[model samples]
Structures are given as C-alpha cells and as structure tokens.
Target: MSSAAPQAPDAAPDQDVRRIDDRSPWWGRLRAAVGRSRADLAVVLLFLAAAGWLTHGLWPDPGSRTMALNPADQVLYEWFLAVDARALLGDFGLLTDRLNAPDGVNLMANTTVIALGVLLAPVTLTLGAPVTFALLAGANLAGTAVAWYLLFTRPLGARRLAAGLGAALCGFGPGMVSQTNSHLHMTAQWLVPVIVWLVVRMLRAADPGRGGPDRLRLLSSAVGLAAAVSAQVFVGEEVLFLTFVTLLVMAVTYAVVDRDLARRALPAFTGGMVVAAGLALLVVGWPLWFQFLGPQGVATGLFSPHYFSADLRSWWTLSPLSVVGGDDAARLTTGPAEYNTFLGWPLLLVTVGCALWLGRRPLVVACLVSALAMGALSLGPRLVVDGQHTGVPGPFALLADVPVVDGALPMRFALVVLPLAATLVVLAVDRASASTGRARRLVPAVVGAALLPLFPAPLPTSGRPPVPEFITGGYWRQCVPPGGVLVPVPPATPRDPWPMRWATATDVAFGMPEGFFIGPHGRNGAATIGTSKQPTSALLAEVATWGLRPAVGEEQRRQAERDADFWDASCVALTVDTPYADSLRGTLEDLYGPSTRIADAWIWRV
Candidate 1:
C-alpha cells in the first residue's frame, strides 16, 4: 500500500471561473437575471403572445371597436374605469351621482373591479378608458396563465412543457375565451393560484413525515392568504366566492379519499384558516359589509338561476368561440359571455380517462370528485338538454336560495371545473413526459388532439356608435358646469347607453339621470339594471322605443321642467344621426324650445 494519501483530484478544468459582478452595468445585471429565469420568461412571453392574438381586434381601434356580443358590459366597465380614475383625483366614494344622477349609484353593490381599476388608473386617465379596457382584457388571460404555470411547475413538480400546456388551458380554454367578450370580472383569475398554493402549503406542513407543521411558516402563509383574499374581494367578489366554494369542495373530497392524510393535515389547516380568517376580516370585512348591507345594496339575486344555468349538452358541445370546432350552438348558453361549459367531447373524454387512470392518487381523486360536484351544480335547479327541459331537478336546487350562493350564476361553477381539468392534464402530461418510448409520444399526441379543437379564436368585435364631436371636442364643458348634469335628449338608460360613453369620454365631467348599472329598484332593495323611472325619463324611453312623437302639452312641459330641475340639468344634447332623432328633437323642442345645432349633435342649455 502507498504510504502517502492520494492527492486531491485537480479541480475540473471545465468548471466555471467567471463571477457575476455586483457592480456591473444595469443592463448586464438584468441580462444575468433574465438568464436565470429563462423558463419563466418564455412561459410568460408565450401567454402574452396568445393573449395578444386573442385581443388583436381591439388594439386596432380600441375607442371604436367594441365587443359585439356584450357591448353594454364593455361600456359599463369603461365607465367604471373612468370613474375609478376620477376617484383617484379626490372624487373618492363608494357611491356616486355620476350615473343614475339625483338618486346616485351604489358602486359597492355592483361588479366593480376597484382594485384592477385603481391599478390601471394611469392608463385610464391618460390613454382613455377604452385603451385601459383593452389592455386589461389581454392581461387577465396572460397573467392567469403565468400564475397557474408557476403553481404547477414549482409546487406540483410538473415539467415546463406539461405545466405550460395545462396553464394555457386554464387561461385560454373555450370558457375563458368566451368570458373575454367584456366579462372582465370573470376573467381576472390571476390571484386564484396564489390562494390555492397557500392552501397546499398549509396542508403539506401538517404532515409529520414532512417535519410536522412549522409554526412560523404557517403564520406567515396565513397572513399571505389573508392578504390575497382581501385583494381578491376588491377585484371580483363573485369569483372569490366561487373560489371559496371550490376549496371547500376540494377539502371535503380530499378528506373522503384519504382519511389518514386529511386527519394529519387537519391541525395545520384549521390553525391556518383561523388566522387567515381573522386577518382577512381586518382587511376586507368593511367592504364586504357595505357590499351586502350598505346604502342601495341589493338584498336579492340579480340573475335568474334557471336562465343562466349550463345546458347538459354544453359539456360535450364546442363553443362558438372555438377556432377549429365552432358551431352555431348558441342555444346551449345564455350569451357569448356565459359560454361556461363548452368543453368539447374529446377533452371531456380525455379528462375522464386521466382521472380514472390516476384514481389512486389522493389529489387526483379530490380534483375529480370536486369537478363532478361543481359540474352537477352548474346544471341549475332543473336539467336541460338540446334546448329542451328535462324536468329533472338538479343538485343546485338544494342550494338555490342560499344567501351569498344565490347571487352567483350557476354556469360560473364550470369556471372551477376548468382549473381542475387542467390539473388532471398536468398530472397526465408529467407522467407521460417521464415515461419512455411509446407512452411519451402517444400521450402528448392524444393531449394535443384533445386540446387542438378548443383553441380560442380572437374575440369578435364591431364598431360602436361614434361619440359625437359635440361631446369629444370639449363643447360640452361650455354647456355643463362643474359637477352638474348633462341630460341626453332621450336620456341614457340600459338600452341607449351611448350617452354614458360621452360622460366617460369627458372623464365624468357631468352626471346623467339614468345609466347602465345595477342598483335598488323597489322595496327590500331588489336588484335591477337602472334606477326607477322619473316621469320625463319614462316618457323619453317610450318615444325612443316606439319612435313616435307624442303630443306635447303644458302638462308635459311642466313635467320635463320638474325632471330637469331634479337632475340639476345644465345641458341636453342629442346625437343627430341616432335612430328616432327626429322624434326626440321634436319632443325636446316642444318642451324646451328650439335647439342649437353644433358639431354632430343638437344642444340645449338647460
């Protein structure tokens, strides 16, 4: 034996000798950082590219192009963002007389995405609300995909390709694409994955085999969860509520599938929940209270559960929004924005097979059970297939009248199913990626086939009525004073919402009598789209609807004067090119005398 010890192996010749300098140029430092996160950057870029394609129509002319399927909602959200910008400049309040003037609108009671609006206030104030709306529409889709991708890759141990595919489905699936037609609230789901991740961490901490629950980690995660919950409340309470329900269902299913695991996780989960609940209350309890019980808050459901429910066949039918397999299956859904259950037959079959094949895994079992439960609830109180009622009661009937639950459209339950389906896909793809030979090629091919037909087409858009130069050219500021009303000739209402666009265009320089908003309409604060009709507004609505000029008399003039005074009217303007303009002009002339033609509209100084 050699007396001397073998010399230490020489340092590997190929070992890196370069060190990242702390004092390097900013661009160089940024480049190094980018190099470290190449995977994440690639995923984000891919999602952004997809979102850009989906929303390309709006970018061409955001002010002129509007979602054809739901322009009212697009206009409404534009107004909301404009109002948010105004609020930042000391116009702060949860209620405003900008819309539904005289009576005012309770913004807290509606689907007001205040957090999103505030975040985009700079864009809304500078570029205008239309630009802000377009940007947010695309961001929601891309941000959601990136958020879910992080969750899948970091926590679930999914391969980059697998996670990206799964996240793409969660973000740009048929249902999500349908919602992009102006359902901003429904599309804002980027925070959901953060909440889910915190939940997973809490449950994992409880396992004794995983070093038991770490008190400090649990407390920090609980606080993080609380913050996320509170922020989501401001974004969209409806989505937050659905997320809670989905989590509860997931918890129950998880417990049923693996008693031992659930029992072990119970301690940490319960502790985290208590802490998170208390902190969330501290942050969002007041806003939540105002939303449910403050001035003008609605006390009843705003939508009909039966009308908004998913059709049974919608699960297998392709959405009209799908690029490859689209059909005129409009009867299966309420409208373009509510196509919440258009998972094609092939994807549904694949999901089922994956769930069954991975049944032994507790998490997979929980996802499958939870998805089925949500799917059942999405059928509403009664089953309908192929546009015909089956007369069979659905599981939702039992929960239809439940307080907070009643406010949610049953079809939105399918939104929860989307992520669950994506989870199954991620697991299946991950396993397939790790497999050798035939399984790898076969599995990816099958997934691609199942997912290809559901690829989203760009959202449809159409030209909106142009805002007349009379309003856009700063002429309205001459007729309407600061914080005063500028009543349109026929008065803005849910049906004729063009005038609302004028107010938003001017950054809400004036108020209007009626607008597109949900508020109290009758006793017990029952929800309706607009305020109760004033005599003058009702008369105008009648003329606008029928295009007939009614006989104007002293009594009609007196009523118009009273309404004008009630609204503190400063000006009345009518777009000259509108339908029934002659009738509106005649009625207004009869009531307030001759009007002055200016730019593209007739104006009367009230």
Candidate 2:
C-alpha cells in the first residue's frame, strides 16, 4: 500500500538544522525560566493562602489590625513605611533625623530590613504602613515555605507531597507562628534553604570523585551565594548569624559522622563562604563600619544574653498562635518576639526519634546535631522550666561574649529545629509512601499524628487607632517650615506613641523630638527611645500615664519653651485621642498660653 513508509519532506536544499544550546540570548533564556517559574506559582499561591488564612484577621482592614503582644513591632513597621516614603522623595539617609530628633539613629544598627523596606515600598506608599506590614508578614510565612518546597523537590529529589509537608512544617509550624505575632525580621527565613541549595550546587561541581564543575560554574555559584547572604543581612542579621553558627556546627557534626563526604565537600564550601563573605563586605562595608564603630552603634549586644535566654518549660508550652493555646500563652513567652518557641511533646519526640533512627544517613546526622545544639542554647544561660531556674547554665553562654553574636537572642536559636524536623518528617512520609506491606500504613498515620496539635490558629489582632487628621490630611505640612520639627505635646511613649504616628502620617516631612525607636540612652550608649524623662517630658508623661492634670507653674512654662527651642520645633501639636489628651492640652495651655485648635489637635507655633 502507499503507506508502506511515511517519509517527512527533506530539509530544503540550503536549510541547516540548528540545535538548541546556550547560544540562546540571555533574555530569551530568562523568559523561558520565568515561564517555568509559573509551575512554582502554585506553591506561592498555596502558601500565601495558608498564611493569609492564619492571619486573616489582619485583612479586610489592614489599617486597624494591630499586634497586641508587641506594640514595638508595629512601631517598627511604621518606621519602615516612613523610610519607604523618604526613599520615594529621593532622600536615602541611612541615619534618620525623624526618630531621635536632633540626634539620629543609624538605620543599620536596627532591624531595619532595608531590602524588604525597598522591595515593599510601593505597597507601603499606596495602602499605608499597617497593610504593608500584614502583606509582608503573610509573604514571610508563605515565601519561606515555598523556598523549602522548591529546594526539596527540584534539587533534593523529594516527592511533591513530601516536599509540601516539609514546606508547611518549616513555614507555619509553632515557632514560625509564634514569631508571626510580631518580629518580621526573624520571620524572614526564606533565604536559608536557597543558600543551602546554592552551596549544594557548588559542592556537586567540586566533587573530585565525579567530573568537577568548570571554573565558570564555581564562580557563578560563589556569586549567587554572596548575593543571597547580602540579601539575608538586610532581612535579619540575627537569623543570618544563627544560620552561620548552625552551618558550622552541622559541618563539624557531618565531619565526625562521615569523614570522607566532609573531606570532599568542605574545601568547596569554604571557598564559597570566602567568596560570599568578601562580596558582602564590599557591598555593605560602610554601613557595617557605622554599625560596629560609629557613634550610634554598639559592638556587643545591647542587653546581656541572660535576659533573652529561653525558659526550658517554654519547650512544652503551647503558643498563642496554636489552636489549643490559651490566653495565658502570652504570659509564658519571654516577650512578644519569642512566643512560638514551643516544642510540643509529640512533635519533639518524633523529631528526636527520627534523628536517632536515621543517624547513619548523611542528611539526618547533619540536621540532628544542628537541632540539638540550638535547642540546648535556647535553654539559656541556666535551665529554667515552668518557673524554677536551674543552676546548670546552657551552651549559649559560651557565645555571649562573641562580638555580634552576643547581641542576638538565645531563644531564637530554636528556629534551627523546625527545618530539620520538616526534613526528617518528609523523609519518613516519603519512605512510608514508597514502602511495601505494613510499613506504608503505619508510618503515614504516625507522621500525621505528630503534627496534629501543632496546627496553627488564626493570629490574634487588636485595633490600631488611625493617625489623626491633622497630620494625615496635610495640615501639619503648612505649619512646619522646611527642616523644622513638629513635636506632639505629649511627646512619645510606648503606650500612646503619638509623635511617631504623626511623623509617619506626615511622611517625615518634619523632624520629631522623640519617637518609638531604639537609640542611645545613657552614659553606656544603651539602646532606648521614645520620650526621655526630662523635667518637662516627665511632667507631661506623668499626666498622660495617670490621667491627672498636675499643677503647671512658671518653671514648667520655662521648661516647655526651653524644650521647643532645643528641639527647634516650629510647631507643637496635640492629638485628641492621645492618652489623657484633654488633661495634657490643659497643662500645655497653662504653660504655653492659649493654643490654636487645628483639626483634631491643638497646635502652638514656636
């Protein structure tokens, strides 16, 4: 029949086949990669949904959603938005006059999260600060989970569902959930796995047993690692520091357990680290200098490590972020920033058991020591469970004097456990699914049960009163001249924080005398902010705190004038909703004569 052979029309006489190769233009390959990323878009969407669901109360009205446990976190977010506004105006001062007024704060010294602030600038500029905070918070959880998921599935060769389990456990587990209540800086852990992935790529390329990578591949990996570390510095330097400590410990553990593999991987890993550190220093050298050696910065931790060390009982306690957590969950925490450090009995047992059972495996051995070491440190300088403090000090006390490491909280070291736990759990789940006979049924059931109580509940939120109309509606702009200060009458305190609110609402158009920021406090260069208790400020703070109008004498009047002159404040305004607003206004009137009413506040032009 005619169909004995089907032959395609031969290439045209002059035509030649062109093979697909690296010859494709850079942008063309970039576009192709972008298209492939759409496959991961699902992971992003799923994570975003999960994060949003957990903190859903923040949505619908992002402006009003507040962090009840950590008011300082909200204050920091407002500062981030203010920074974004300044950046939009073409003013990129790393040291801001908006906070400490005449004196300023080195942004590098704080957890400013410069990269996140810049990246989310548009969202903050448009919807306002609180909304930007909520979005970032959600993104932090989701993005972190997705990053781990990609690493497990793409390079580590884990199954899809298994990878997802790993991702969820890392992203939304109790530790992460607790941090979500506040602490945007610590929550930004998405980059850790990315660094690991890049390091792995370099290690594979450098493996002598196989054909090692070319110079170009090694260089590329090195550069990539450098970029990731630099970005991580902006997100959370403490986390980055912890990452470094954890990696070193894990590497040592691996060397002890599997010397040959360590021998193969260590040189390449060390070379890559050198490259990354050198590049990071080059990019951020000046800022780092200011942070460590300049006027505002402190070389060591601002507080003693003992103050931030975790209580041992915190390991078994439930976090407020958990569905089963009670109202007292907040009481158990060291502060607003460390709530989710809880490691439930079941989850802890499974993770430790898996680490023990899978000891011979390279992945398990490396992760096991990382978790154990960090966990021990989280127990703090001395072991404290429930309420009693034990005389036995923990491992972290050794690092308390180690330069920058001293400044970081020991409790946060617990973050190392979640990812390791996730990896172990995923391996178990995947192995069970792939196994034969009775093994398959039992393992999955066990894995599911271990994670049951760890499931998160929606994050609790409170209402944040909106900024007054005087600043938001732009009336304050008319009052304060260029470079002049706008000092709120009650000044700034942790509770009310009016000056900070007004300054943020006005987009830092005017300087502020005091704000809710960390800055030089006493002779020690100790970190503190908000209104200092000067004679005049103390009088105002007293009335505000006690809701009582104290007698204002000529001394108080003279003191007010002196403060305004020193601050160079062009105008002094008072918000109606400020704590004991009326009383403070009455006291101000007694001191500064009759004040002009403007919008929802009283203003006095200096």
Candidate 3:
C-alpha cells in the first residue's frame, strides 16, 4: 500500500526554506544612528553657532560705518567688493579679467584661493556683499567641520571625544586664528583633507578584492585629485603644500602595504596627474604658453626671483602658543593669539606615542610616512648648487619662487603644514584612545588641561579703534556714482623703495571713474608689490583675461584720472613708521595738489 500510494515520490522531505536578506531597514537606521552619535550633533551645532556669531561680529558692513580693522579682513573686503562689481555686471568673463587685473592677480596671482570667493558670486547677488563675506567666513567654519570629520572619523577611527577635540584643535589652531583676517586662502586649505579622504575611499574601493579596482573609480580619483590640486593652485602654496603632503602620504602608504596594490594605483594616480595638468593648462598654461612661447617669453623672465626673502622663524611659530611660549616669543608677541590656540600639547605627545605603537597598521603607517615626507620637504636642504647646475629649480625653490607664495613672508607654506599637524594631533589622540583604558582617559584629560590657559576670554572692545569710515563707504556704496571709479592705490611701505607703488595705483585708477581706491592701504592691500610691467593695460589686452567681452568705455579714461588723484593723495598721504610714506607724501604733492583729509583718508585733485 505504501508503494502504491507512491509516497508522492517521497514528498521531498518538507524542506522548511527560510530566506534571509542581508540588507534590512534597521541596518540603515543603525548606520544613521551611529553617524549621528559619532558626530555629536549637539556639539557641532554649538560650535557652528559660535563661529557664525564671531564671523558676523567681526565682518565690516558693506558701505556701513565700520572700516576694515585688520590687514587680513581688509584684503578680503576689497577682494569681495571687486568680485561684487564683476558679479553685478553679470560678467563671468571677469573671471579671467579679475585673474589678470593688477590687484586681482597681484593679490591672488600667486595665491589662487582667492577664487574660492567666486562661489560667493551667487550669494553676493542674493544677499549682498556683507552676507557674501559672512558666507565666506561661514564656509571656513564648515570647512573646519568637514576637515574634523574627515580626519577623525575614518583614519582616526571615530571616537566622539577625540573627534571633538580634534575638530576644536583645527577650529582654534594658531595659524588658523592668527591669519583669520588675512589668510582667506589658508581657510580654504581645509578642503585638502576632504579631498584626501575622497581619494582614500576610492582607493579602498579599488583594493583588488572589491571587483579588482574599477576604471570609473580610477577616473573619479583622478578627477578628485585634479580638483584638489586646482583648488590648491587657486589658494596658493600653503594649501598646495597640504595637497602635496596628503597625496604623498597616500602614495607611500599604497606602496608599503602591497606592491601589487601600488601597481594597481597607477591608473588612478596618473588620472589625477592628468586632471591637474589639464587644469593648470586651462588656468596658467595657455596664457603662459602663448605669452612666453614665442620670442617674448624669454624677456618675461618667468624664472626670476621677483620677491624678497620670507622669515623662516615666523613660519614655524605661526601658532599662538609657539609665539607666546616658544623661543621666538619676542617676535610673535604682538598678534591676537590669545584665544584660539590648541591646549593639548601633552595629548599631542601621547598621540605621537600611540602612533608609534600603531605603526604597523596600514593607515597609521601611511600617515606617519606622509608626515615625515612633508617635514623633509619643508625643512630640507636648499640645493642652490644643484638648482644652478640643473637650470631647472628644485620643487621647494620653485614653490618659494611662485608669486603669491613668495609674498607670504616667513609662512610661505605654513598653510600646507597646518593640516598635517592637525591630522597628526587627531591621529595621536585616536591611537591613545584605542590603547588600554588608562591611556585613553589620560590623553583627553591632558589635552583639556593644556588647553586651559588658552581658553577664550572676552576680547576688549573699548580700546578697539573704530574702523575708518572711507574704507566703509568705498566698500558699501553699491553704485559708483556714474562718473566715479574705484582706484586702488598702493600703500607706502619701507620694503617698497621704488615708485612702483605709484604705477600700481595708476593702473587700478585707469579702469573706472567711480573713484573707489583699493590698494596697499585700502581694501586688498598686502605686503607685496605688483610687478607686472603692463599692469594697467593687462585687463584691456585679452577678453579671456578678465573673463569679460572686449569693450572700451569712454568714461574709463576720465575715471582713470580721478582714480589717479585719489591714489596720489590718500594712499600716499597715510604716513607710517617707514620712510617710504614720507617719499610717497612728496610724490603725491608733485602729482596732485595738496588735499584736505576726508575722515581718516585724504582726497586730492590732480
């Protein structure tokens, strides 16, 4: 009977098939929860608010009564105003024009980070210049947050307290705070770490086992590398150094981990190089090629050292703590390093120890190698003899010889080192935390303790002099009253022994009649002098130069004259503790008749 019923062909044995899906809704929820916790949303929010308040409070209102109080802020204000003008005219072409403009290229020529302000063009249109500057400041803050997350989360392995401290260290780092007013480009330097993290992610994805490294991933890495390099070029050398160090670290790490992985990394590495080359061609290569390629190229002397020596001591002590307590205390005592310095020196020591302990870990080993490489680069031999023999300069000399970077004085590449330092500090803290229990608690406690002395105190407002009114008026006055032009006059300085300053003033004055001066003493003023032989005419030479359609305005000539007078009078009139101001006073009297003072600024008629 059992055979007849046929047992339904043995009825398969009721195999209770249970399907399990690896992906679950709770998985996403879990990830989100973890990310939120690691980030410390509340603390981040608080820091953001504080940053916003400080930015808003310190920023001068466009056309308001407040004047630019510091050299750094002054430069940013002028640069913003210039950008605002170009934006108002809807002249995207000015991208080129501004780049070539005497002041535009002069201030930003060597340092490309000034271009980051271009992102503010839309913001400027929507909210006005004040808001744009505010946004710019906010972007710096956002960059810090991104940098913190990037440094602490993955490579440092996300510990909330360590991450928070690392972020705070970056936000309040000495170089960051010291140049807060002047180093807008350095502020943009924060982007480098983010880019590094992206590259690392792409590299990790391409780790051979994961589908053997996709071409797309390689392409993306290349694109990202190009973008990072381009951004550094825009920001100038400091950021450039950071980018270089970061890439070098990654490259070395890849090399050490697995020779095969290093080989595989070639495509991505080359792709990045190609991208960077393309961008360089677009920005400086084409123009330089055209300008210097022919017979005239030799005359330009692109290889010449057009600037003076920068102080080495200043670069090393850019931090407030270093300035105050380090050996070079006397030289750095004057700046505002009071509030924004890192307090975790002992923690930093512990971090170093932990890093040494974790030296075998791939990421840590890579970072350590990177740090050593960067240090060697920054502090390596000059190789003057080698440079002369080779005709081609070494990388360090070439970097120092670059225009904007050359003018950075002692801190020529400090922008580059700051991130490395920050990363080391973060990594160190992370390592300590990961070690045995005692070390973890000790690291944070030591850091907190060191930071105690530098805790921010209420900055005094009473002694804070009112920012000049003209600086306010020129920056704010939306429309350059039809006939008026903004003319920038170079401020008189002991370093500027020649009448070259006058030429710069004349060049800026030649453009528009609104009579708004932006020069050495005005907005966008800096320590270096413009050296372009045809500074005044450069903007008119090429449509691509100012990113504007080529057109001439009749009013431009008359405006130039008015601007010249303003430059001759105001900038020259503002005397200093230097002899150059006295020479400028005499030069102004010869060029334009004696003029009465307008607020703190003097007005002269040619």
Candidate 4:
C-alpha cells in the first residue's frame, strides 16, 4: 500500500498544456487572405477611383457658376466661417454673440449640420470651405465603410464576403448615394444602420451572463446610443424616427426576453440618453427648451395627424429614377417608389420573408415588433383606415398630438423604422443562409443583386448640362456682405415652410449683419444664445409682432437706418415675401442714395 498509490503523474497544468493552435490551416488562411477584407478593400478602392474620376471630370472650373453655393449650404457655411474666424481671433464674446443671435438660433436647430460645421470649423479655418467639405465628405464615406464592417463582423460571424457585400450595399445604397453631396447631416443619417448594429452589440454584451465590467459596457452602449441620438437630433425629425425605432427595439427586446433585464437596462439606457440629451442641450439645448417652455412654444402648435401625412407618391417619382425632380409646387399621390427607393422594395420583401421565416428567435421577434411599430407609423393614416392599426394601436392618435412629435414633420417618422427593417432583412437572410449550403451561397448573391440597382449610375459626361445657379436675394444677400446689420423684419407667416419661414428673416437681420447664421428659425439660434437674457432690441421689436407686414414698417426702417449707421452696414439684403423688403429698400435708397445689386437680393454700396 506504499503511501498513496503513487498518485498518477500529476496531470499537466492547464497553463503548461499547450492548447491546440486554433489558427486556420494554410488553405483556410489562403482563402481568408483572398477574401473579405481584401475584397472589400478592392471594392472600396474601385468606388473611390470612380469618384475621383468623376470629381476630376466634373470638378468646378475656377469662376464657374455651377459650383455656386446652395442657399441652405451657403447660409451654414458662412455662419461657421464667421464663428471660426471670430474664435480664431480670440473674440469669444463676438463669436458667442453672433452664434446666439436670433438668426443663429434658427440654424442651430439643425443640430446635424451644425455639428458638422463645428467639426469642420478647424478644417475650414485652416483649409477653407472647399477643402473642409471635401474632408468631411470623405470622412462620411469612411464612416459608412466602417459601419458596414462592424455590421458584418459579429452577428454575421465575421463572414468576410457577406461583410464586404454589406459594406458595398451601404456605399452604393440609394440613401447614401443620393446624399453624397449634401454634407454631414444626411451622410450621418445614412449611417443609422451601423449605429443600430453597434447598439445591438453593446446590448448583447450587456447581458448579465456575459458579464465583464457591465457598467463599462453600459457606459459604452450609452455613448453609442447617445451619439446616434445626437446625430439624429442634429439632422432633422427624419432621424428622430430612426432613433425612436432603435430605442423601441432595445426596449421591447429586453421587455419580452427578460423583463428583469429590461428593467435593469432602462436606467442604463436612460443614463445613456441623458448623456446624449445633455450633450445636445450644451450644443443647442437652451433655445429648444425655451421653445417648448416660452410664449412662442405654445403658439407653435404641436401634434396634428395632418402634420405627419405627405404625398407618398413623391417618394418614388421624385428620385433620380423618376423623371420628376423636386417640384415643390407639384402634388402627387403615394406610390411604392416614393418610400422604397432602389433597394427599398427588395429590402422590404426580404424583411417580410425573414420575419415570417424566423418568427421564433427572440432577437428576430424583437426586431419584427420594432419594425412593425415603426412601419405602422410610416403608413400614417393608411394603417388606421385599413384596420391594420389594431396591431400597434395606441393613442398613436394621442401620441401623434404630443407636442414634440406633433411639432415636427411627422411623415419623417419613417426614418425611425428603416434600420429595424434593414436588420430584419439582414437577419432573415442570415438565418436562411445558415440553414443550408445552397442557401448560404445563394442568399448573399440575391441580396447583392437586389441592392445593385440602388448603386449610383454612370452619367454621360458630354451632355451633363450645367445646373443653373440661383441668384441670392433678400435677407441672405444683405447680411452675408461685409458691414451688414440685422434689419428687424416681421415674424414669418405659418405658410412659409422651413428656412423660408423663420430662418430667412433671422439670417438676413441677425446672421447676415453679424456674419453668422443658424437656420431658418430662431429655434436653434436661441439655444446657442443660452441663458443670456440680454435682449436684441432690433430682433425683439420686430418679432414681438407675428405677421410680416408690421415688422417691415417705419419702426423697422428707422431701426435699420440706425443699425446701418451704427454697424456701418453699407448695403441691405432682404428676404423676399417680407413686407419690409420694399420699405427697407426705399428707406435705404432715400437715406443713403443708390446701391448696387450683387445678386438677386443683395444690395451693395454704390
């Protein structure tokens, strides 16, 4: 019995035992080497090369009017330019003043564009607007690429081919392609899918069983969600829909899968949202808060079902494929093409198929519910009248009337549903592919083919007619020139939509003269104004009255005269449709004699 039967040779310690090198075999390595990353890189490079060629061929010739600025873009560009110029010169007060001015407040509401402007400030300051635009655009493209990579990596199991295809789909997708020249806000909007994917991953990681410093994971998730939310807020109400859909998906998923987890997730989610909300507030929150809280806020009238409805036919017939360009005056009916662009229909079909097929998986179910909820909103009144509203019935009617939701362009809610739909389609195809060999090979191909038409089409170089430049007139021309001053103008009529409504008045009066602008309304600009209660006598006097006529009367003219004298405004620019334009023009001419027309609305010192 010699002691303990000579204990068997101590098993090799886990640390000492070498684990099987799970490294891919040489053939597998070779296949991977030639696959995914390499292929994706090649595709990306090809697209870039094509873009480069197009840029070169279509590059705006020096002095070419074709490159003349888009009015909306010009307003933003100049505003940022002014701020960056002031910030660089150490005139923080001046910069702040110009930013907070009524006009500045309006533009600031466009958080997406404003954020881009903020990011681009340094570049614009250093490299100038052209280069800044180029840099941001390139970055947006890169972002799309990265987002695609992330999307394909985890849920799709690092399937390089599929990832590459997805990335290509995003790059060439109708949404991305159409928005190429629009700048950061729309570009960021196009990245919503990636944002959704990242949020999903973080949520998955946050699963308690998958524990590793969950607080850290929660923080990371919040940051991503917040960033996505912030980006949406900046872009417009359209993106808000996307953010809502994403949050709803996460919320519902957690609720159905594990109510306890959902409960736990809420605080973390809220915390993340707060972070984003706080950031938004810091950037442009003050004015938004004021709008909701102040006198104008109540008068603005939020939440109307009619507000959400749009002529759906425009979605299909107005895109590049349709002969109709954006005829703002034209009215059209709802059609399949309007809402679902090139890839839209195919994606929808696939999504429906996937929902039906993978109805069992919790993730799939969660995605389905989220998509249907958003889709119902997108359908607007149709869902209710058709009796389909029973599925998601809520006081959507009540919710629709909620101030925040109602105050915005309600039709834009479709954007919120998009990512969920995309995820569902991807998941369905993913599941189908995983089930069998034929499906695996065929699924991605079908997805790819379906998305192909959405890619940018080659345009004929010779006949590419020159786009006409719009003559800048009115308020835009006046305030943008050197030595301009805010000319008090009347509050916009409700019928005037967007920049035309509020931004036009503010940009001319405040932004033009001050050398900074925000948007079409004082909403965003007022936020930038922060808590500084200092009144803009000129602005207050004019906007105190709602209609445009009185704002342009003798009182405004006398004030404009005084401002011209004080601010050394050599010219006056007035936005058309304002009663004050004619009065201001006559007063200026009578007082200062003659002025020259720079563009349409701009009047300059003779």
Top candidate, metric TM-score: 1
Model 2, 1-606: lDDT tens digits are 000011112100111112223688877666656654665687778889999998788878976667766766776677666675567767787787766677767787787888888787777777777777888778899989998998776665555566777899899988898788768888899999988787767666655544553456677888998889888987888888888888778767767876665676567656766886788888778878887677666554565667677777777777656777666755555765676568677888877776665445666777777888888987678776666677787887787677777767788889878887888877666665656767567766776787878888877788877878987788887779855788777777656664576666655667777666666664566665443655777788788789899887888789989987888788888878877888988988897888997888888887
Comparing 2 with 3 on TM-score, the higher-scoring candidate is 2
Q: Against the true structure, candidate 2 has what lDDT?
A: 0.73
User: For model 1, what is the error of residue 158's alpha carbon versus the real structure, in angstroms, after optimal superposition?
Assistant: 0.6
Provide TM-scores for the models.
Answer: 0.93, 0.90, 0.62, 0.63
Candidate 3 residue lDDT tens string, 1-606: 001111121111111111212354666656656655544667667667755654554445432212123433433344434453353455443222232222332233333244655655555445455455545555675567556664565443555555666676566555455445534656655666656665665565455554645667666665666666665655544556556645766576647665666665556555555664675567655434432232112112122222222223333332333323443432432344221223234434544565675455455566556654543344222322211322333335655645433433322333334444455555556556656778667765766665444333221111223334444345213322322333323321222211122221121222321111222322233322332323222332232223343333545444435545533322322323223444443334444447445544544433
* Alpha-carbon local distance difference test for all models: 0.83, 0.73, 0.43, 0.43
Weakest lDDT window of 10 consecutive positions for candidate 2: 1-10
Against the true structure, whose lDDT is highest? Answer: 1
lDDT of 4: 0.43
In angstroms, the error of model 4 at 580 is 19
Candidate 4 runs further than 4 Å off: 1-40, 46-58, 61-107, 134-142, 155-158, 168-172, 175-184, 190-198, 211-213, 219-241, 257-318, 321-344, 381-396, 428-436, 458-591, 594-606
